[model samples]
Target: MEHANDITLTVNGTRVSRRVPARQHLVDFLRDELGLTGSHIGCEHGVCGACTVRVNGEIVRGCLMLAVQADGCTVDTIEGLSDAKELEALQKAFHERNALQCGFCTPGMLMAALDLTKKNTKVTREEIRAHISGNYCRCTGYQAIVDAIEEVVNGQG
Candidate 1:
């Protein structure tokens, strides 16, 4: 029998409580339970960074974290960040730079970019690349994405 655990967590500024499977991934729980689909499931592993989300103010691989592990923690998805206007500049920069193609990786890319930008205001291109190395974008060849993030870091965006 599948075990279910009751969890209460804050998501996107809203308090939510639910009973989820013990093994359910945080991203799956967010998408299936709360209808927050901005974070896509890619690779189903931590390496792709496609399931990136903010947990307790830090970026984490949602797919690698169980929903029960997030109990009482604050979770922020792309939808929440966008709704809060926290990703406005990055979104605008990404759009203007044509940083995304298929868009499958945009949400995770944005999350990673936001984390890096928050930690460092003045960043080099190499540093930017290194920061986002975990996120894999099948399209765009990463050149435009790097440019967009660099622009945001340099205050040009």
Candidate 2:
């Protein structure tokens, strides 16, 4: 039998409490329980950044974190960031640069990019590439994605 634990966490600035399976991944909880599907489950391992989410101001792989581990933590997903207009500039840049094609990795890519932006005001193209290296985009070849992030870093976006 699967064990369940009661967890309370702040998601997208909203307080949420739920009883989830002990082994339930954070991404599964967000997508299945909360109906927040912006973060996609890619590799299921932490290797792919498709399930990235901000936990207590740091980006983490949702797949690697269990739902029970997020109790009392502040979790931010792509929907929340977009709703708060925190990702407006990056989103605009991504669109203008055509950085996203399949869009399967867009949410995670944006989250990683946003994290890098918060860390530094100025970044080189290679730096931007290295920062987002964890996120895999099989469609765009990453050039457009890098361009978009560079534009945002330079304050052009």
Candidate 3:
């Protein structure tokens, strides 16, 4: 039998309570339990940013954090961001620039870009690259992705 821990948290502006397995990571809980599949599981080591999400308003790797650790915190996934219309410019820019090829890393890249742009939308291309360095995109080679993010940041989107 798997050990479970009861926890409560706010997810995408909704209050949620569940008995999660003690070993369950936040990504697993979000994907398996809450059915939020936008946050893809990549390396499972926090090295890749595929599972990036906002916990308590800070971007964090879902794979590195346990579910119970977020008991009283607010979790925001790509679904939430999309629903909030927070990623509209980035989405459009990504599409126009062909930043997403496989679409596997788009969510995480968007999440990371959200964090960066939230700080300063007028960021340089090198700054954008530095901010998104953690997110690994195997397809785009990053130039298109950088162009997309730069456009959005530079207010062209």
RMSD of each: 0.9, 1.0, 1.2
Error of 1 at 57 (Å): 0.5
lDDT of 3 by residue, 103-123 (tens): 999999999998888876488
Checking candidate 3 for backbone clashes, the offending pairs are: none
Per-structure clash totals for the candidates: 0, 0, 0
Predicted candidate 2 versus true structure: per-residue lDDT over 6-125, tens digit per residue: 999999999999999999999999999999999999999888899999999999999999999999999999999999999999999999999999899999999999998897679988
Model 3 scores a TM of 0.96
- Candidate number achieving the greatest lDDT relative to the actual structure: 2
lDDT of 1 by residue, 1-157 (tens): 9999999999999999999999999999999999999999999979899999999999999999999999999999999999999999999999999999999999999999999888766998899999999999999999999999988878865
Per-model TM-score on C-alpha atoms: 0.97, 0.97, 0.96
- Off by more than 4 A, model 3: none
Off by over 4 Å in 1: none
- Lowest summed lDDT across 10 adjacent residues in model 1 is found at 116-125
Which 10-residue span in candidate 3 carries the lowest summed lDDT?
116-125
